[model samples]
Target: MNPSSPDGHYFSPEPSVASDPRVVDVLLDGVDLQLQSDAGVFSHGQLDEATRIFLDGVPSPPAHGNLLDLGCGYGPIALTLATWSPGARVYAIDVNERACDLTRDNARRAKLDNVHVSTPQQTPADVVFDAIYSNPPIRIGKQALHELLATWLQRLAPTGVCYLVVGKHLGADSIAKWLTSQGLRVDRLSSKQSYRVLEVRRTDREQI
Candidate 1:
């Protein structure tokens, strides 16, 4: 673990593990999704705790346009969203190029043609999302992670919402408060492994 990396998780632009990553199967919402992950991606070995909490709280298949998994590690949430909501498209984005590639492979193996995996900069700037889901990278420290979340949360469509998973020990309550103060309606949807699942909605719709 490199102390230089905040979480001792090397999510470098160019990671040292050069060979193609190995494939691993993850169970989400009772469905299996095959993913390829190595050093640079989040939860390289298996499903991370926060994501399990988020998956446990995911209500039902959302009904339309695009659902996004920001900071998607290897397409589990993205693939699950696509699988659950056949009518909607799923976009998986991450900063790690290797992670993006792994997501693409996972989507391909799952036979999901509609799931698009891309780097943060590759997504069209004009695109708006119907819903966003993430098990945020909280260990990156509060301020940086907040900035990351704020950027994507602001991209939600008028009727959109974001589902987030953050551990209580990692300041989930403070984040919920922060989102609420930002004029986004936030609800604590579930609690597991001392993690809080948050549901966020934009406030502008109150006028409608």
Candidate 2:
């Protein structure tokens, strides 16, 4: 098991405090999703710049069956993904209980009962994602961040893909190389404002 975070990593299941609730709404690929937020969580009041860039960079999933919003905070990406793909069942996982509760409530408010919001450990064993999307927490340090990604990358379905947004200064290029070394093909699809949108997949193929 990885060591518990001193930085109060957002992925830590045990949260520090309960933030006051507020609501936020956004349009993603023509779908409008409204979710609640609270203080101290990632992008609590409105969509954070990184996630905004992430959404802007990537197109909506053509088809969604099983999806994951890794480190889903207050359900922005997860809720938007579900709204965009009605056929998808999104597992919104976070370590913060308050964030989890907020996601659950926000999904309920959006009338999207298909989103399963809970802690990382609450996710079932048999679930394999068709798509995994996240604005991964890079401040968590390289080793810890890699561990987080590694745990979930293995959960990708045979043809599944993950969309990630990372700041350029945070070693996004090195991360791509590392993923490539892991046999997961990582493509730097787009870059802007020193941020990168990476698309990763696993296959029986050689490095480029």
Candidate 3:
């Protein structure tokens, strides 16, 4: 697979891998999911630990409204969000074309019509999310990660919230402080297995 970015783990703009589909079976909230994956996507073999932790750590999302699965890899978070909130529109955004293809396929296999897989450039600028979920691409480095998070976090509605999972060694605490300093309210919702689950929202809604 052609490495899209320097760190090189499926943050590619266009992956060189052939359209060979693979399978990943994951159990979210006791529901088993067999998602279509590919060689060039993140955690293509199976669900990654950080994502599993994020899924387990987060509560069921709001019943309705638009939601985002930032840096979606084969649509796990997006599909899960669609399953958990049937009335919501789940946007699965990824920079990798191959990953986007896999995500679209997985959404179809899951029989979820609500999942919209797209690249960052394709997502509407005015679209605001009710909630955002990610096991973010921290390996992309601090500067890029900050830019990515800032871009999406700014798209959060006034009452929107974002659930993110980052490993302790990957600067979870520092990232939280950085987010807070940017005028977002970041709270540690859970810390388990060397991973931190951060709950983020607009500063004005901090008390809400």
**lDDT against the true structure, each candidate:** 0.80, 0.81, 0.87
Candidate 3, residue 143: lDDT: 99
Per-residue lDDT tens digits for candidate 3, residues 96-130, read 88889888988888898999999999999889899
In candidate 2, what are the lDDT values of residues 9-64, reduced to their tens digit?
A: 45556556445677787776776876778764777789888888898888777465
lDDT of 1 by residue, 81-108 (tens): 8888878889999887777888898889
Error (Å) of candidate 1 at residue 205 is 5.6
lDDT (0-100) at residue 16 of candidate 3?
A: 61
Clashing pairs in 1: none
